[model samples]
Target: MTPSNQRCSVAIIGGGAAGITAAAVLRKRAPQLSVTIVEPSSTHDYQPAWTLVGAGEYDVATTRRRLKAVLPAGVSLIQQRAHSFEPTSNRVQLEDGSILEYEQLIVAAGLQTNWQLIDGLVDTLGKNGVCSNYSYDTAPYTWECVQGMQNGRALFTQPPMPIKCPGAPQKILYMAADHFKRKGRKVELGFCNAGPAIFGVPFYAKALMQVVKHYGIATHFGYNLVAVNGPGKEAVFETTVDGMKIRHIEKFDMLHVTPPQSAPDFIKNSPLADAAGFVAVNKHSLQSTLFPNVFALGDCAGTANSKTAAAVRAQAPIMVSNLLALRMGSALSAQYDGYASCPLTTSVGKIILAEFGYDGVVMPSFAADPRKPARRYWHLKKRFLPWLYWNQMLMGNTGPDWHAKREYPDTLPSISP
Candidate 1:
């Protein structure tokens, strides 16, 4: 078969946290190797701040930056969406019909937000008091809706499983409640969660329960939002019980909706994906099952971990190592034992830093007590994490041992292993 162009040492298929981080680590470790990033977006988002913005902590200007500024200089940056992958030739087909070849491929394209999954959710997001922190445009609307309403039913709905920052849906809820409490206008706060429990992790869930009671938030488990009548200010939810239920109408003064999410369409339809549409990779190494040259990181990888950017910080180094190893024609040894994290922002001053790996409770960073909510955790999330994410992680100036060393468990192996 004839090829279209010269094959690259590595073609990273994304410019977000995972992809860029991998590129930075690769260049730092092996400067001689050439890297090209194929990304569609010119602007990158610091999504962790979106929750803070929805809570009136930050404005839109603070959450975004030019992608060119963040990416490592001199690397070939192809600003295009990867439309399809040809693992046989180690090539990716861009949306513009251009093809890129890579000795190694890192699919850190991340998850897709499915606002269209819910009927009428997209049509009336910015208007009709429908707001979500998932988007930059809708985040301020959340604050706007929160501000305008004094004392009426304010419904916050968590769509379905596996959205980024699973705790984020409720985090905004608590902050909004805290806002009303401060103003002496504690409106009706209802948490319509799709999950069966308050939170997947129990340790933090216990702390969450205390806060829920403190703020007097009505927690409804197993209730999923099915439809939104935004013009009428009404939301329809379906109950997970045996009822095969229809919509239960609930009028709202303000509605904050976290939409359901899934893997990107291309990955889901490709052989690279699992049943859930996530890229099927070794849970430890993040290399694809079908192709050794192919790897995935971040939310798109099918690992048994909470999909969080904090986890991406840890996985980026592992992916880089394994990708480099594959390029050197060696067996991978680095493993990423599903180390995902979520910063459960209980309030403006408090946070439960939920850092755990697979098989429940793997927090080597939190040597002290990972269970209890600490002011230190709050400080780290509110003050330090953003700095660490931007100045360190994105800029490739992170902790010295971030991707170079393993600190979690002695018995476990690296994800690339």
Candidate 2:
């Protein structure tokens, strides 16, 4: 059967947080422009809540909704994977041999979590106390592993950078440590990270080190998890000392692995990609460097912002605004300041909401000391944020009402548990 070519005013790739939000915004601002979303997944996940799910503080089912249920009205959905992009022709090729021609294109296809890059990981996952909060099936198992452990070594591994939610790998670790604390059990906890620091931002890292000391957890920087032997309860890591590569093996009763991630291979090999295999775009405008009509945002764009849904929230409005400017044949006026937020859950009821812009400048939405762990932020993470995410952000409410504001720090009193 031959699939006929379809044309539209705009085509959006990927249906995750970024794509759906963009479609909604486009539909609201430009009702006449035909907008189509190219996505293959039937389910959309609120991924930021996965850490809570892994900590037993949340139900995983609440983090998901059917794709059709959340998409904005009047926006078209193409339930197919994008095979490749042909920017010169302003068309996207789908896996089913159908072609979509568009006056403007936006690529929001997110990064790929390559679990297979770690040897023996695929076979061992979801068993032998091996788990990850990164996947839907294994997140619940992480809570299982945390609850079942009595007093043996529990290892949490964080791979190299450019991974989504850079603070997530440690968020679950904190949850497990807090869980063990409540039981009066001391699990020999270790954080094996490929990076040299606890976090990218210095202000937040200084505060996180205090939490690390509070837990008495061992920190091994420059160590990357490379393989797992589930049955034997062993994990292998590669690191360097004195400019020499070395292998370190550790045995554990429980292991939470955050896998290495990268741009999807299709995007990496495409002509739209930059040197590092991400969509080449102007950092501020998010307009493709090669094609004027094409734009990109989210994890797939070669931008310096931290890869988190909060970043997508800030980028969404800017991307849509600039995209419309392009359509008008006017200069792009909107710019994304590389804003990203990570609500670092330090305990079941406390979170340090770290929000920053380019060069790690603190850009707290509220003027409170972002360094302090607070109960309100936890509720924001657990209660308010999720509702806002579904009802507001994803629905294209990107005006001043939707913007995050910085208030006076001293005015907001901190609450203690």
Candidate closest to the true structure, highest TM-score = 2
> What's the number of clashes in each of the models?
10, 1
Name the runs in model 1 displaced over 4 angstroms: 1-6, 362-364, 400-417
lDDT at 168, model 1? 93
Candidates in order, TM-scores: namely: 0.92, 0.96
- Can you write out model 1's per-residue Cα lDDT over 284-309, one digit (the tens) per residue? 98899888888999888888788888
TM-score of 2: 0.96
TM-score of 1: 0.92
Q: Ten-residue segment with the worst summed lDDT in candidate 1?
A: 408-417
lDDT of 2 by residue, 70-189 (tens): 989999999999999999998999999999999999999999999999999999999999999998878999999999999999999999988999999999998899889989997999
Candidate 1 structure lDDT? 0.81
